[model samples]
Target: MVDAFAEDEEPISLPLHASSDEIGRVFNEHAERRSATLRASTERAIRDHFAEAHDGQEPPERIMR
Candidate 1:
């Protein structure tokens, strides 16, 4: 997962006149957006998986002993 954004750490060779702080802020925002997306996707996947796994399943009866 760390490698997924390793490229962001490297300097951008573009000739944009933005300051280093501005560039850093942009990268931070992009990273935050990506993290949010991943979290939402993971939550959906987990919910779907658990729902399918429990489909048509019943709880065990309690013992009276």
Candidate 2:
């Protein structure tokens, strides 16, 4: 499954532009967007999962794992 996910993920390359600050800002923005997306997706998944559980499904582990 891990390999399958890896295969499905699009390859990305971080290319630096002329300004280091601009590069950092771009990277930070990318990270923030990704974090927001993952947060929303996990929230939805957990909501569906715990909709049946008594105490609410165990909240998803916060770790990167």
Worst 10 residues of 1 by lDDT: 1-10
Maximum-lDDT candidate: 1
TM-score, candidate 2, is 0.56
Query: CA shift at 26, candidate 1, in angstroms?
Result: 0.2
lDDT of 1 at 58: 53
Runs in model 2 deviating more than 4 A are 1-17, 55-65
lDDT of 2 by residue, 1-65 (tens): 12333333434345645387767776677667666766677677677767767474566666775
Which regions in candidate 1 have their CA more than 4 angstroms from the true location? 1-15, 56-65
Model 2: per-residue Cα lDDT at residue 50: 75
lDDT of 2 at 9: 42
- Give all candidate RMSDs, comma-separated: 10.3, 6.2
Residue-pair clash count for candidate 1: 0
Residue 22 Cα positional deviation in candidate 2, in Å, after optimal superposition = 0.2
Candidate 2, lDDT over the whole model: 0.61
Count of steric clashes across candidates, in order: 0, 0
